[model samples]
Target chain A: MAQFRLQGSKVLAVDLAGDTVKARNGSMVAYTGQMGFKKLSGGGDGLRGMVTRRLTGERMEVMEVKGQGTCYFADKATEINLVRLNGETLFVESDNLLCTEASLRTGTSFTGLNGMASGNGLFTTKVEGQGWAAVTSHGPAVILRVSQGLPLRVDPGAYIAHTGNLHRALKSGAGWSTLIGEGGGEAMQVEFTGEGLVYVQPSERMTLGGEV
Target chain B: MSYPPQNPYGQQPYGQQPPPGYSQQQYEQSHQATQAGMPLPPQAPPYQAAPAGQFGAPLFQPPGGEGPQLWDAGTLPANDNVNPYCFSVDLNGAYYLQKGKMIAYYGEMRFSGIGRGALDQLLERNFNSPLHASDWVVAEGRGKLLLADRAYDLNSYDLEDGNLTVRSGNLLAFEPTLQLKQSIIPGFLTLIGTGKFVAASNGPVHFVEPPVRVDPQALVGWADCPAPCHHYDHGYLHGVLGGLRHLTGIGGASGEEHQFEFIGAGQVLMQSSEALMADRSVGVIGAEPGIPGAGVPHQQQQHGGGLQGLGNLGDLGRRFGL
Candidate 1:
């Protein structure tokens, strides 16, 4: 088992004791002990996974790192978040995944119209199984919990990822009022209900739709 | 080894992680069921707030864990920062925020554009920037609202029987208890009375006692003082080379040409960076006579008193874009 920890907010330190982990290609900045790196064609998801990745355009180049003592991974100084998975599923943008354990499975899933509004993609990357994984963001990600009576409304551009059982609906306040430029600034939002956690970055990404 | 040059598209070619749950195959099995109109089982119920060693569901970590610190409707702060870059305003009444600064919120909240609806009455009392009213909104009702701006450093100040003037673009939100008025200087607004307001800076803000001169680009705002005036280091402009450098960009001119002079008893705020922020106009004061930046006929404008013999009226006229 590889122990995943943060060197700081920006650097990810994963300790591997004769185990293998998959990381974004070229993300290794430094490492100690003996390590072997081999490029995994098509996201390390095997042949069919590659085909699906190519079709979805959520392609990622991953490398398998074996027998590493302590390996440091970082990408452009972005803040890294570590999530431990005993057995739940995480849905994230393909571009936001940094690294994960080989025991976990990565795949693609269709996200319906919610993707269209965020200007991300029609399909998002999904990770499953047991193990630890890393995610990156422009700034620290704030995790907000949603449960029975508390439904959370989030700006599509600020949303990064979320977990647990939940349902999402694209709520819009746009109308003739918006046409005349009197539209409320919070016109476009994604409402999450049920029980789970939603991760939102402090900064928003510019999408096809104007800030809403 | 070369990692990808920062994504040319700026946003693409990037990462994500997920905590393990019951199972991926199981979620997929139930995901399809839920997608097909069969109501799926509810996820983990709102777990009691995580204690020191025990973790809650996906959203929260144990008190000392890497998971996010959870703040529910009752636990969120009233008018404090959730983080350095994000502010959580517990709005019981109304607050004015630059349009589109909100990232997320919980509970009941209604956002309305300014200068319209019942908001006009509210604006009539608290707002004075009519021309720029379209770029603002009134967030009313009660909720824990989160506000952020482009990930800049944000700080909120409390004013008790006092006042503050800030650059229009830097002011993110303010309480209705403070009356906002246009400052004598262009591109700034003055808030007087007692309330809290949030502002953003290129970096953390450094508060300095007044009787100071600062680079205009670094000056964020000042409190309880008369308008600042320009101070030029005219010693450099004494010779012909200086005149030529000022007129044409041929010779290297020291980047610092002037500074804003602040005097009297007050506080001056400056950001670490010198990059200036651009803001929309707070409304045109009309071309009335005697108004400082208003409608004076071009010919009547005066020349700079500092560069007397070196430049004449024509050169000075162009300098101020008269």
Candidate 2:
């Protein structure tokens, strides 16, 4: 098993003892002890996942790190968040997934129109199984819990990932005013319901519907 | 060679003891006094201190794990900052927010643009800046609305019968009680009346008393002060060589040659870094005579109007070392 920790808020230090972890390709800043880096073509999801990723445009470049020391990973100085999963799935954007334990299975799932509004394509990366995975955000990510009746609405640009059972629906605030260029700048939102946790960064990425 | 006095304003030198009643502490005390004296609205949520672990060191252990603080709707602070980069507004009635600054929210909230017919009366009273109409929207209903801007440091300031002028892009949202108007200064907006507003800065914001000259890019806003005037370093533009450098770029000019000079009694807000927020159009002023930024086309105003229109004249002059 590999243990994940933070070396400051931006760097993720994973201690591996004859275990393997999949990370963003070339995200290794530094490490100690023996380490081997192998590029995982098609996100190491096997041939089927590679074809699915290519078709869905949810492409991810992954590398497998197997070593006996503390391996460090960072991506563009983004803040790293650690999620511990137990027989559950984590739905995250490929751009936000920094690393995942080899025990976890990675795949793609259709996100419907919510993906089109966020400009992240119709498929999102899904990490399942019991393990620790790392996600990246523009700033420190705020973890919000969605329970029965207490629904959460997120601007697509700030949404990074979520876990547990949840239903996501595209909520549009666009009205006649939006067509006349007087619409709410937040014309589109993703409404999440059910029991789960949502990861939202404190910043917004420019989206197609951002200006409207 | 003798050097000219750097403190050309003839005021107290920088870092010296400020006169009585003008100290930073006194300003903060008076600021708090005003806040304390103000009456809270009926629907306004009770203000809560920001969560302890949201900033700096974690004072309390995480609820159930070793990760960041997990905030549910009930745990979210009411009308307070979730972190330095994010502010959570406990929304009941309404708020005017800059376009697309919302990151997330809990509960039921509807965002509408200023052009909605129902908002006309609200706009007439609180929003007076017609040019900025397109960039602002109204958030109404019940919920905790989160606001952020490019992950910049966010802070909320309360105004009690006071006024503040801020860079247009730095202001994120405000209550309806505050009447927003265009500042006389280009690219700045002024808020008047008693209300709370959230603003974003590239880095942490430092509140400094007036009698200060600040780099334009570092200035976030100012409170209860007259607008600042541009001050060029006289010594930098003194000699013939200086004129050549200024006009022809024969020698590189120091970027700090120009600053916004502030004097009198008030507080000025400056960011820690020189990085500026993206410029938001303050809307086109009427092309009337004597308006500094008027008469020029909107696109030309962004690049600074005068010399840009001359075009190759400057390049041609630089070629001959004019």
Candidate 3:
């Protein structure tokens, strides 16, 4: 087991004792002790997963870190979030996934049209198994919970990830007014239902549907 | 994937079932535990329970990261900020928000354009900036709506039977109870009556009483009684050499020659920095003859109808008893 803790808000320190952890390629800022780094093609999900990642455009280039010391990982100094997963899956943008435990399974799942407006692709990365996965965002991520009868609506640009067996539907508020300059700028949205947790950044990414 | 714009209200789309949920009991306990900063007793498997509150964007890291505090729906504040950069509006009726500013929300809500719709009557009452019509939307329903603007510093102000004028671009959202109208000053919008509103600034906002002169770019807005006028320091315009230098920049001009002088009573709001939010045009007031602020354009008025370096002398000649 790797001890995942924050050295600061922007850095992730994972202490490993001979076990390996998968992390973003070239994300090491500093480390103390012996460490081995190796690039893993296809996110270490295997050949089938590699081809699936290439096809879905949710491609993640990662490296395996095996050692007996504390390894630091960071991405352009963006805020890092550490999520502990037991068995359930975590769905996140491939670009936002900074690192994951080697034991976790990584693959892609069709996100329907929700990715079209977000421009992250029609697929997103799914991480499962027991491990701590670290994600990044432009600003701090606000974790929101959606339970039975209490659904959540999130802007495509602000959405980062989610967990649980929730159902997602792509929604568009576009109409005759949208054709005019008077259209609501938030003409597109993603609606989530069922049980789950959602991650949204305090900032929004520029998306195809953002200007409507 | 295809959610119709007019989907029936209160109906779940796509045959989605809520899944066997964490009993309300378990959720309440974990929520309390997290709120109390108590170690979660592992009432449920970490894999089975949904993580509530915040993670990732840590405010401050303790000696060791036990993890940041989380805020679930029950704990997320109503009509307050989740962080300095994010605000939450507990919406039971309606709110007017700048378009595309919402990051997330829980519950049912419908966002509609301010133009021709059932919102016409409401828009007629609260929304008055027609040029900015394209930049705003009316969100109606019940939910906790989160808002942010490019991750800037956000603050909410309560206006009770009072008025405050703000740069159109800095305002994020406002309650419908406040009537919004175009300010007599172009590029600014005035909100009258009561209710609360959210505004973002490059830095935290600072308040100062009027009878003060401020840099135009640093000013956010003012509340009541203070009238803004242009001011210039004419110390160097005494000789022909000075005149030529002022005209050619040969002797250099003090960058602080111009400022907006305010007098009388009232409060002036200023952001720490001069960096401004992108301007959203409130549109022209029309070129109608005899209307005081019509046709001249705001830029020209603010700049005194000419370039700053050369226009200062002309403006001085026009001022009384200078």
Q: Tell me the whole-model lDDT of each prediction, alpha carbons only.
A: 0.73, 0.79, 0.76
What is candidate 1's CAPRI-style docking category based on DockQ? acceptable
lDDT of 1: 0.73
lDDT of 2 at B163: 88
lDDT of 1 by residue, A59-104 (tens): 8999999985999999888778777666888877777889998889
For model 2, state the Cα shift of residue B199 in Å.
0.3
Every candidate's DockQ is 0.27, 0.37, 0.34
Candidate 1 vs candidate 3, TM-score winner: 1
List candidate 3 segments past 4 Å from native: A16-20, A32-47, A64-69, B1-73, B230-258, B289-322
Error of 1 at B158 (Å): 1.5
Quality class of the docking in candidate 2, CAPRI style: acceptable
Give one digit per residue, the lDDT tens place, for model 1 in B1-322.
0113231222211111112232445434432322121122222212233332222343323235545565444444446566677777878889999877888887677887776777778888899877667777888877678888777777777677677888888889999998898777878888888777888888788877768999989988887664588877756554567556655646655767678899887778898898676566555677777666655654653544544443432354245333
- Of 2 and 3, the candidate ahead on TM-score is 2
Question: Model 3, range B1-322, lDDT digits (tens) per residue?
Answer: 1122332223443213222344445544543422121121122212222223232221223334434444445555566667677887878899999998999887778888888669999988898888777788899987679998877778777776778888888888999999998887778888888777888877788777878999989988877668977787767865677666666778786788778898987778888899988775555678876555687543444434444535645554333222
Off by over 4 Å in 2: B1-66, B296-322
Alpha carbon deviation, residue B155, candidate 2 (Å): 0.2
Q: Give TM per candidate.
A: 0.81, 0.84, 0.78
Q: What share of the true interface contacts does candidate 2 keep?
A: 0.71
Question: Residue by residue across B1-322, what tens digits does model 2's lDDT show?
Answer: 0112231212322123432223455434433543332321112122233343332221113243344666666656556677778888878899999999998988788888886889899999999888888889899988778888888888888888888899998999999999999887878899999888888888888878789999988998888865598876647544677555556666665677679899876788899998887777555788976676776653433333334322322233333333
